[model samples]
Target chain A: MMLRNTSNAVYRVAYESVSKLSRKLNAAKNIDELSSVFDQYLKYLFNFNALRVHIVVGSDHYYFVFPLKDENETEFWENEVLNFEEGLLENGVPICQNLNAEQANSLIGDDVQNPVLWGWNFQYEDYCAVTSLIADENNQFSSKETEILGLVVDLFTLKYYELITKAQLVEKNKLLEEAVDIIKQKNNWINQIISDQQNVIDERTKQLRYQNEQLMQLSVLNAHQVREPLSRVMGLLDLISFVEGDEFEEEILPKMKESAKDLDEALQVVINKSIEEIVNVFDINSDKM
Target chain B: MNRGSNVLKVLLVDDQKITNFINLKVFEMVSVENQTIDYTDPEIAFRELDNHNPDIIFLDLMMPRLNGWEFLDRMKSQKIELPVVILSSSTSPEDFSRAEQYNNVLDYFTKPLQRDDIEKLLAKL
Candidate 1:
């Protein structure tokens, strides 16, 4: 009856520990958070002195080691882990072994005496995870314990995939926001360019109006003032037509010469004035530019 | 009407000496019997208007000292009854309208005055 009572207590403790470990794993948000949870809980649940986790997704490998005993031992363990062959643990198999100092030295280049080694391999989709645990020979793992540890490794693999997927989603959101900001900036720049072009059109319209006014003024001057001398030349020519040869030479030729000179001078003045006005308009436009 | 006994008196007033000379030549070509008086200055022309007692006057519009419009106004005030014609280089409609407002102004003509225009005036006389 006492043995039955002791077995009931042990079962209750194991059930409580598994519930607590599942809660901690579910609460983990990132790699660092999950790694800390594993470091805190896995050793206590499985009675391991040290732990190493190696996960490979695509070309990337994520590795973690907890409670490193010494630099030499860590170096030796790292070499063994790097050279470890696959297929040692099959899909449904878990490995648990006890090693002497000589065996440990041959495997890991370390003289660790009577070490207990346990490892498991798990795969989900295209990703793989390999886990290793080391303990003192006095604390050899049972088959039931190895089965429980296999379940823990599987839980870690699923949590790791969740953490990586969440991180990728966050990175994509940041990139999308940056792309939107760039589009908004380009739109603003195009609006500014359109406004500047409108201003240039308005300025050109004003200059054209000014030039039209100058042209009208020049037209008026040409019609009235410049035409006066031309009329005199016409009048002189009419008189020459009326008179005979010698009379035309003596009487009308000198007057015709004078009238022609006056016409030439008037035309020159008008041309110079027009050129001056055009130059002034160009100078004003250049200054604005 | 009595072309043999009575001489036709003609007067010309213009700021341009060339215009007056041309008009005098035209009158000589038309008839040497007609008396022609010409002046470059409108003020002198205005003072001599009664002294000349011209039968017909050819007046230019734009002149210094006294313009054609002012000369016409003075002629009105002095009650100088004479047939006056505008002989100007201006083709402005406004000048033509303004000259038509005067009772003494017989017609408006743009220069240089043709033989046809002078013959028309002679026909009126």
Candidate 2:
């Protein structure tokens, strides 16, 4: 498939979501808040967390800072900070920050290693101000939303590959079908040739049978009608060949020789016809027998 | 210092550190007096833009989290109608066609963005 005409609007929404989530993840005070926000934001957009989030904070007061026990403990610390801020605010501390108690808690859960310091104001010296570093261990803050979006892109890419493979399979199947058809056609032709050969053999057998019957019929006919006359003609031709030539005898002898040759040729034709009839009769009798 | 206020402030957005450095150098050599806010993180980039309004944006098309087109879309939604020049190594016809669809995109340039290219873009401004 070709690259989709992705709406600039969709791209913008995805981008802003990523930016917002990244900002939130960075603003988060501990690992607990980070993972929760990460999980919540990503569950909607993607299935995997491709971009690993790492949070580390450098505390202003080194003695008060506690080591991050684990990811779960970090979330707990963030929750505690929220409760602490709310308690302080309810007691009448004038804070100009726009974040609500819930929003603040959600923003900076237990992900940070140190207390994030905001800009210090001389007018509010009594209140602690801290800025949060929204970063992984490498100081990179890839938002949970962004990570999920990356996963979506990956899944889409895999789907595209699957489509291509399916198309290839379809083409291969078409070629296979054509090959099968050709093979079937060749088989039919071979079968037809075998049938024709069988037909030819049957015709030749019929002809041989007819010829054998004819020879038998001619054998009977030749015994009565042909042999006696043919024998006499042959004797006369033999006599004419032995005679000497004289003036008057020569003319008479030539005529006699011509007549004997004609008779002999006629007898041979009669014998051949008689034999053909005999074979035909014999072939008919053989079939009956 | 008085003339500095009149200079164009160009924001260079890219995930790679070296690309940002190279672009910044090119901008400088073009005699364009400008301050660049480099954002390797696309999410961070939007915040930087909201905070510091730049005269021009040189945006890369590909990145880990927020791609160039995504960033532009976000910027447009926010009504930040600043001049945006798409800086990408992809010169595919389809890429160019897609870039053309965006009204905010002043031009599409194939990268290693040169000083001459920057100068040419500045002249257009």
Candidate 3:
């Protein structure tokens, strides 16, 4: 939004008024100084209402945060701020003449929608200085005020912007510090969880290794035991086969077949046991790996 | 009406009258065990706190005259240790953490008060 040429005269007058107000505001050291400055500023800026200004000042800005004075005073201030916008500009043209306080409500009236034209925002950034014209109903630049208000506003804004920038930097620094602390906290917590999980893993690995050793010993022992049984069954089968022939064609042949069956059963048991042992080792090793 | 030792006195603080009304109804119908006194004005609520040692307090955050955070600050400065339960529609994580930071807070519950939630919460009490 650049400054227009139409509102040169009015912009200077408004800027002068604002300069006076700003000087008073800057000079104010205490409540008394503030009150005096605010009184003059309100009178010059808003002549429509009857009010006495009492406001609270903070480090960066003024807070209407809590009303420190009589409740009636607030109503008066609102009335002035609202009605000023409802009034006319230098031109005969009405910003929103058809609007009424009861029906349209000043809050939603011409000032809010188009403040620059109505001179309602005389204290607004640009208008506060004398560098810009108050825009018209069509938002055209003021033929009377021009860019004087804009210049003053720019100057003041630069100062205020610098302060705001510093504040923002401080806030950002605080946020960065907080983020760092949170990251540190999360890192510590994750480390703790990892350590706990590692301990459990170590304990489980030790138990599994011991169990694997025991199973290996059992497999070797069981293999030896199966071999002894198989050898006994084989010897019996051989003796029967040798005696069977013609003399034992009936009873001797039946005994030889029974011995062979026992030997086959023993060999099958040994093969099954070996497979089971191999599978157990594979499962344990796969899980650990 | 009858009075007993189990009959508890509770304080309800919020700027919104509708919220206070709904909370009161819920308290009468759903609260397992407690009596209540409701106040819309935060300043008045603080005064009521001083006068009445209520069993529990249900507080809201945003207010016109005095905000909930300000009320809490005052209470803390004054060393007023009443078990406060934050009853707010705001589910901001910062608000939750802030409530936790204070020792006076007993619990935090979001809006649209549920019957089962209140029952379980009261059962613990």
Better of 2 and 3 by lDDT: 3
lDDT scores in order:
0.76, 0.54, 0.55
Worst 10 residues of 2 chain A by lDDT: A117-126
Model 2 lDDT per residue over B24-102, tens place: 6556556767777777888887887767778888888767788887887887788878778887655456668888888
DockQ of each: 0.36, 0.00, 0.00
Interface RMSD of 2: 57.7
Indicate the DockQ of the complex predicted as candidate 1. 0.36
Sort by lDDT, top down from the best: 1, 3, 2
The digit string of per-residue lDDT tens for model 1 on A1-289 reads 9999997887787667767877888899778888777667766665655666677788777776665344335443463334342443245255677767775665444534478777777666968777776677555556667666767777777788888888888898898889889989999999999999999888888888888888876775675556667787887887766677697887788888888898898789889989989898989788887
Q: What is the lDDT of residue A266 in candidate 3?
A: 58
lDDT of 3 by residue, A204-231 (tens): 8886787777676555444333333333
lDDT of each residue in A241-284, candidate 2, tens digit only? 43456632653344445545654665686678876666766776
Ranking by TM-score: 1, 2, 3
